[model samples]
Target: MNALNPVFYKEKIFSAAWFRTYGLLVIGSFVLAMGYTFFMTPYKIVPGGIYGIATILHYKLGFPIGMAALCFNLPLSLWGVKVLGKQFGLKTFICFILVAFFADGVPFLLEKCGHPHPYDPFQLQDEVLLASIFGGVVIGIGVGLILKTRSSSGGTDVFTSILSKLTRKPIGMLQMIVDSSIVLCGLLVFQDWKIPFYSWLTIFLMGKVIDIVMQGYSSDKTFFIVTDKIEEIRQYILVELHRGGSIMPVRGMFNRTEKEMIMTVVSRREMVTLQRAIYKIDPQAFTTILNAQEILGLGFKRLEE
Candidate 1:
């Protein structure tokens, strides 16, 4: 095996990545809970998942939303740990507790700060759409941040993750199915078709927001470069970029000459460095670049054992 730089391979206790993930989780949980407490609950917008169901119960029996969500998500999170492994369990458990804490705490703090009814406009029966849009955007960002760490907020996320492992199906679509079921239940519980429509709208907006927050407008880029100086370009990619790619044998359509096609994926920032190196080595190299929606491996995800 080729030896890797120790500095490149090492992870320190004081690493920025660790602190960033934890910081996002804490902030995401608080923002998510705030959306639930202030916007979603007062308007009865069941945008899906365990929290949606908990909201229904909160209205019916005057139960605490946070406590209800914790009760449901705890078992699901444990089951997810058994499937996904220990690190996932730890992160998910943290998300669960923090969300539950903030869900209850935010309202208490708000009242203590002298705003006894902060979202009172929602209770007035005219701002349902506004509440749903704002609530969906905030929760979508929270969920996206949690997912960025490769950890979930449990509930239907766990179910979809396990199913994705087994069936290799799209987790987003699977989650939509689960959330749709909850929306259907909301219809029955509230006996209002309007509720389902509003909930559906929120769900749609939330998905768009999640996609934007997770993938960004053009965060990832894929490059396909064809050059005569293939060896030099390949070495630069390996030694400097520290990234791996495969060489594909190709026949030029016009010349019928055999050639090597170099293909790689990189972040937007990395693409600039790679392009500069390629141009310096082979000024007339043919290159194509495209946006990459997602890539899993190496720097992106843990390698499979």
Candidate 2:
């Protein structure tokens, strides 16, 4: 698709959204680099990703983490390109290259510019917990930005994909297993049980932060109401909440009575009002509310362009 339609992809890559996405990617890359160069690596906190392997290699075999990471990521990045798609390949390549340079170059740049890598944090706030939390949040935002754009920098992302394909497992489940394994490896390799705990904390927080960054914190509750007083409920929703929804026919399994199910999506705050209104109208209303990560339409944000 990218090869046959360069103009579309080219213009898309240079569009405002593309600019924002890549800008976020750059900032995220720097943050990820800092988490490794300053926080995780310095403290030997291997919280997965390519840097996780790089950390063990750096300490055990005296490997240059930057080059090691580049070496480690090359094949996975290519694999992402081969299997995922060209756009993903391009973005992943860009992100990986930027991170490779930043992770190695940031400290040198800072030292050259006058402020050397501060040792105060290393000495004073050297707690594994601190490293885990801060590093996770930073890395989460970084990875979230890359993923929000539907791009990746390979590493375990590719590993997870491969495992999922081979094992017929969900990508998320496989990713979790792989990340957990990295933490466990840290525990075994370093012989510190705390490493696994802290690493797991990082992984958990990182996943949550990634969810929040990409999905946003604003949550919605979608309700499917099976009630006899459809008009009353529908009217209240339309007039009170200024929202519209669909009504469909459904039969009560136990009673075998025909009924209408009102399906509506509303923000969390609106849930209370909706429920109360429904209750006032039909006290015996059978309502089921489910969490909505996103609701894009008339009342919510428009679909991405």
Among all candidates shown, the one with the greatest TM-score? 2
Model 1 per-residue lDDT tens digits across residues 1-305: 98876455333556786687788889888888877877888888898888999999998998888999999999877877788766456778999899999898777777778885854424646778888888888888888888776677877888788888888999988988889999999999999788888888888887898888787655788999999999999999999988888899988999899999999887898999999999999999999999987666677744431
Off by over 4 Å in 1: 1-11, 119-125, 162-173, 219-305
TM-score of each: 0.68, 0.85
Candidate 1: 10-residue stretch with minimal lDDT: 5-14
lDDT assessment of candidate 2: 0.80
Superposed by TM-score, candidate 2 places the C-alpha of residue 254 at a distance from the truth, in angstroms, of 1.5
Off by over 4 Å in 2: 1-13, 79-88, 116-124, 163-174
Error of 1 at 101 (Å): 0.7
lDDT (10s digit) by residue, model 2, range 191-267: 98788788878888888999988887767898999988999889888888988889999998997999889998988
Note the residue pairs that clash in candidate 2.
none
